[model samples]
Target: MGDVVRAPWDAYFATGFDTCSEVLRGRNWLAPDFAWQERQADTERWEAVATQEMTKTLSRLNAPEHTCQRRSLGNLFDRSTVQRLTPQVEEHVTRLLDELADKLRWGEADFVSTVSEQLPISTIGSWLGIPPEDYPHILEITHNQVHAQELLPTKEQLAVSAEATVQLRAYFTEMVRRRRERPGNDVLTGWIHTWDAREPDRERADEILYRLTMFVTIASLETTATLLSAMVELLLREPGQWKWLAEHPGHIDSAVDEVLRYDPPIHINTRIAAEDTVLAGVPIAKDSMVHVLYGAANHDPRRNENPDTFDIRRTGTHLTFGGGVHYCLGAALARMEARTLLTQLLKRFPTLRTVSPAVYAPRLVFRRVTSLGVAV
Candidate 1:
């Protein structure tokens, strides 16, 4: 079969590395923005508050709107910001690892719960000035809300996502209101001030700020958690690699990149054809939807020498964080979190081993590992 093939569901699946790269980097390929949503025949699905809100997010918008919204938080995960935030990430990783060690002393510990899940939210929550008490609720709602973003969400999943979206909207709305009333030296408060200065209408400005805050917070949680967990899982599954990485801590960055290529947090990204186009000899009509399978592309033999093998020192690129315009804004932060956690984790527990095979949630787009039992 060729690189681009039509799936049973009617959408095209770009499986080859080159095909996926072309789709992502091409100017004609667009995110499923509001206009795309409006054009869809399934009016009811598009009308849901969750779907509507998702389309408005920076991830879903296109062209001028996406450019404008992204520009607002452009430098958020830049080199300087990540460098400034590294020490904090390290601090959290150290504390979480200590807690994990305590749990391991008693018995096998769930690394997903103790470390992977905690570090991302803790780092982002502190940065956004959200109270630590609220992290659990935010995590719960974010988990539910992400179901709506799946490649083929069922009725049940959409309902759950809608409910979660409502809760999230209310939660962020109130949080923005409070921050506006009592300005804090936090990222959210700073955004509120910036939007207030830009937009004349207070209500509109608040809405923009709330959406931005909700997206920023939600975007960082589950994906980064999955990255951290998968990184540990991959390393532990290979004892020699783990030992080598522990001995040579400088390879942690490459190790993290290898894990991302081997098992990315998100496997599929949907893009619509802006105009008539042909990919890998397959003619695609205007407005056609293409599902870029990142996992498949990453493992394509044409892309990597031995795609099945997890080699940390391999020098190649993966579309894990996507490519071009809609590439993940939190990529740098996520990498930093993974690198920091792995660096500290290897240093702390060189003999760490997996208690059993990892358990994963039933998700297509987002690869969520539900549990990873480990012992030191």
Candidate 2:
């Protein structure tokens, strides 16, 4: 396929590194926010509760709103914060590895369920002061919630996503209320105070805090789990790289970046043209939607040498966390989690091996690996 092509469904697909990067970083491109959704012909699709809830998130907002909200929470994932959280990440990794060791003694253990899924929820939940008892429910709802984010969700999937969105809202609303009743020195409580102080309207503050809590939980869970599992799976698949990493533990950072570039958790991102634009000599009209394929672009030979090869030594850049104003706020935290997990995991189980190939769910935009069995 050419770098830019029109899909049969009328959306433009930007698959090359240059084209995708331009669309992502260009000022003329915008996320499909609420206003854009309202302008679409499919009223019923845009009217779904899940769709509406998603458009309100930090990722979907444009310009001034996005700028303001992002600035408010900017320090949450800064280098110092992530560095301060490293010890806690190490503690969680150690605990999870100990549990995995017990399971390995019996037979092959599912790394996905036992370690990958647990670490992220444990870390973020503790940070947000959420009780450990609630993680299982959060994980379930988060998984169901992403169906609506799929490239082409079915009617049934949309309904499931809508229901999940409702459950999440109710859960976070209660959590925010409890935090107000019994304040703690946690991220959620801090946000509550910040929002309340800035906005005199109590109801509006609560609403913003509720959405922030829900978004942080949903954003951190599945995607980080996928990253953790993918790192382990890829390393084990290439025994030499696995052994090399075990010895040269200092290269963990590079290894993490390589894994992100080779197999990102999110493959596609959608953006709309704010005005008439020409991409690679092709004219795109205003309000046209373009699906930027990060996965395809990451493998573009023009951007990196031996693009298909997973070489941790190569210093390569990727669109995994996106670009421009909508760059991922949790990038630093996610990197810290992966690095800590990999370092501790290798130190504990250098002989770890994948007993079976990863089994992924039927997803296009988000890569969801349902199972990855491993033996130590």
Candidate 3:
């Protein structure tokens, strides 16, 4: 409505919520696959997303408590909490790199299939207590969710999502139950303490946890992994960026941030207007769907200088993590993952190279790599 133009509320109101409308209205377009009290978690779509679902899911979990749940377990985002968690992340990145370096016996290897995917899933999965073997299955769910309409997930996709949800809920429910019985140092255990016995909607707590887990799992998966891969891919393509990063290692953090803006893992966000509104002087009626193009916003000449360049030194602001109350909560984790993974790549595989002919994610929403073959 202001700095960013949300979906066309009136257009959404006119066409109603559907695949196309969801893309257009961006605001509150519920996932049709799964049912939520608010935006129903689209089971089919979630299944197809592989990764984007994760990024989107996490965003929803951390969304305002008042709207979705009376209470949310977003303490994971507090600056103090992030600071405390950084060390563990650093260790994980280092260990992951060492593990990769150990496997580089062959002269050449596909880094994307090997190192890039391993870092985020391993780290994020460990945080949530999910076994590494489960990464592929969960990732598949995320892929399905994001690409549901295209893959046209038949009844089979819905069936898989349903069965998977049951399995996941059973797992989390048992996990939550055990944590409540005898809590541990894990975040889930801590979350159980605050999330226990959601009085008004006791029954909904299960769904809440389900959605919450989806949020953490899906959000971090795409942003962190994709961004990490994108960074390494770019360095290989430009080559010079590697020299700049190596010479000015101190700038890696800022470089990661710039890359996020220059080639954001997420390109557009869909929002459905809560009511009638006008955006960028364009009049929109109630319930219109709006597509917030963060990629475009980051490059908006009005807000930035030389928006086309990928200068790590460039600063100001961008909606890479979005804006306003519903902004991404795991931005810190995403940043940490990207920075750490990038650092590990430079150190362990200084001569890392991409296989080339990489493909852009076929979606109009989040921007990411569908396939990027790289060497280690």
Candidate 4:
């Protein structure tokens, strides 16, 4: 659905978990095309690695292995874990806000480049067992990996950009191996044991590993960073929402949701037609590349009243995280990070405000507030 991201379109076998949930009532899919791709082999090209190699990783959110992994790991995002991470999240947020306040004391600062990016990168890196010292590198790799359009730089060039990813995968592979030799407490260690125990097939473990790495690789930072930047942009553009959120404090969850609907982090995902079908009466042939216009779909008047309006108190859930069996595995973790970051940002800097007009790439596939200067 992008204006021009053709060669490197990279349509994920992704799902709008909620979208499917809405249409199917917890039983079906939003589009038949999406359901077909859910079982396709293309996704296996990458996901196979995660499930096959990682041993413990369940590639499918609906699959039994994934269910077990989700039960174990998903608990990390539940109330107890969220409660546990709150203090640490706040402490980290305090450091960032203080850093921002310190810098703004001198002059204007690019908050998106400096602050928004830092929050998710740190949170995700910690979640993935990456060291603090390497977050900058992680950010660079994830950033380039997502934007590697193969336009100026061919797929080969894009692959070169993913050198860090290669290194990252190699590192994780070693971690998985070491854990097999001697276990530990981190999620990585847990994943290794799970992967080793499942032993679905000889190659299954590698596939699982790929899926697990890919799970956190592109989605983690891209979703969080883009959403955070969009939050700053919307809050700055709409003084009322910003003021309301600042005052209510508890409305941070609503603010996060509104931010997602107003300017979702991801805008487009494609689905291959399962067979001949119709989308809202439009004939769709089998194997057609059907673009899911999430941004437009989220704002469809049929779905939301005054779809364009940004109301933090808006009660309707949106399609930012997606729907169905393919729903984002990281949804809970992401929500917690957003709630924590926004809370800390608002609390520390009551005067928090963007100082520059945000810059966004016209790229339609992903909508990220690339840069937003701010004043504390």
Candidate 5:
């Protein structure tokens, strides 16, 4: 355990294994505090509708509301549900791999765009009841939302993303309405049924729909894409690991976990202290902005020996998925996606190698390579 380190912008960063773990499990809000909000507002960076709705999202909510939302929607992503959907996942994986094979035959292919990005969107889009035609629109919005959060985005980029957020809310709002009128055989319909049956008022019904839908669309696609891309980059960089995987298919799960630990898709999880608390012997003041560096925490030496090494056989839990009540609801879904894709990738393209230099995205909270050129 270590003392919390103060950062430049009135922010506190909790590092090490125990410190960050405690902060995540403690009373905290995923959303920034009033001070941070004021700073964003002062700079005209705050999108009111997006900010407010995101606060109610599954990851941001606390207490009975979070519990209720989690329980109501939990079945949609339960073990049995994911198992039932395995064939669908396999279908997407096979199609994407086939496409990649074609691209690879033509010399080189951008793995991130061709495979890492499309699979999650197609799989999650189908689950969300999004029409195939609407995926382009939704993917555009997700890209805008993700890019707008860069370490140093331009003013114009912020404006564009704000508009995208508004559009995303509206899109979901209408989607929820349609689902209500003629419920479908998809996850959104299940969510609509759960929310409407519990909260009948039309306005609250709409609110529930918009928030959850937005959260799911962004969270599922972006983080999983990042994970997939990073996994490919890491494995390809260490060709030995690739050969090892091809030889020992049983280690695929460990490889996924190792990739998660080595370069977690989500690097930093922002939390605001709800009340005065002590984390790992560090006194945290109320309303303090605490950055639980999951990336750092996962790599903490205390938590894992030789933390810097990318060893699939390494043993220990990692905080790639946060701890306690807010642990990722999509953990299983993400794991399945990575496992299916990586297993198929190793089996199909055992000799796949990078054809171009890796280029990383300019973002701190998330880790993603902009493009990964590869060939067999």
Candidate 6:
């Protein structure tokens, strides 16, 4: 067993499969309380404005609110919704891949920008009825905001992030107004229907819709973008496996799940101890910060027979989307997006291979490759 890695703020890292699972699934630890109003309150900076506001999102909400939001919006992400989105996803994947065909033949092309980054933003943004023209600006704003959210960000960094957050809030506020006036078949419209059902004046509905929209639009892009690069990188590491997948297209489903398990986009999920409890015999004081290392637990030998090996046929589930109440809300869409793009990519260019070493973005909470060059 490894020793506990503690941060300056007294946060504890739980890397063991059993320990992490227990902490994540049990009621001992809870999501962020969102009670803090300022960023730099104590000696060590425990939060940033970006993170502080993010705490108010569905992922970080406590009990009743979390349950209400999840239930009301759960059907929108069900398998059927994903199936319905398949054709649109395919069109985008095809268009993006076609754009890269000429560039890849030169034996090198930055797939991260050309494919990985574009696919998610385009697909998710289009699905939500975000205007085609606004996507680039939105991605840029979110990128800046996400990077500025360092544990100990500089004064300048915080200032920039605060501005970006303001821009995002305004963009979503206007978008929500438009969607409410002219409803359609997209997710925003569906959410509008749910809220419009009970709320008469639309005050509560507008607040809820705006928050959910801002959070989902930004968070959704991060995962799918990273997962696209990570999955391709992992498969090409074992060319034989990539070839195997190309031959047996039916394995795409398992392939996507395995990628999520092997190299999850989000590495750590935090939970505050609700009450004093013992996790794997270690005492965790009430209100202590617990970091559940999903990436580590995913590869724990005890949990999987050969955790290091990236086998598409690996059975059971991983903590990639997490577990219990906080499981990733967009899990279905992420899987579908990855599976769709990879399946089509391999079929179109069976000889596609990574040409350069992957370069990861500098971030603590996310595992995103900033650049990955590939050749066909």
Best by lDDT: 2
Tell me the number of clashing residue pairs for each predicted model.
0, 0, 48, 34, 0, 0
On TM-score, who's better, 2 or 5? 2
lDDT score at residue 80, model 6, on the 0-100 scale: 81
The TM-score that candidate 3 achieves is 0.76
Regions more than 4 Å wrong, model 2? none
Q: Of the pair 1 and 2, which is ahead by lDDT?
A: 2
Candidate 5 at residue 32, lDDT? Answer: 58
Worst 10 residues of 2 by lDDT: 67-76
Shift of residue 39 alpha carbon in model 6, Å: 13
What is the TM-score of each predicted model, taking all chains together? Answer: 0.98, 0.98, 0.76, 0.78, 0.92, 0.92
How far off is residue 374 in model 6, in Å?
A: 1.0
Query: What's the C-alpha lDDT at position 152 in model 1?
Result: 79
Segments in model 1 whose C-alpha atoms lie over 4 Å from true places: none
Which pairs clash inside model 1? none
State the lDDT of candidate 6 residue by residue for 117-221, as single tens digits: 898889888888888888889988887777544444677776677778878888999999998789887778888998889567688789889988988888888
lDDT of 5 by residue, 1-376 (tens): 3547887876788888788888777655444533446554254444444444455678666677778877877655788888987899999999999999998888999998898889888988888878878877887787777655553457776667778888888898888888888977877877777787899796987787778887878888878988998888888887588998889999889989998999888888778877777766677777677888887888888889889998888776799989888888788999999999998999999899998866777778766677889998
For each candidate, the alpha-carbon lDDT, in order, equals 0.89, 0.90, 0.59, 0.61, 0.80, 0.81
lDDT, residue 194, model 1: 83
lDDT of 3 by residue, 301-324 (tens): 666688887777777466677654
Worst 10 residues of 6 by lDDT: 35-44
CA error at residue 324 for candidate 1, angstroms: 1.3
**What's the alpha carbon RMSD for model 3?**
6.3
Off by over 4 Å in 5: 1-3, 28-49, 147-154
User: CA lDDT of 328 in candidate 6?
Assistant: 78
TM-score, cand. 5 vs. native:
0.92
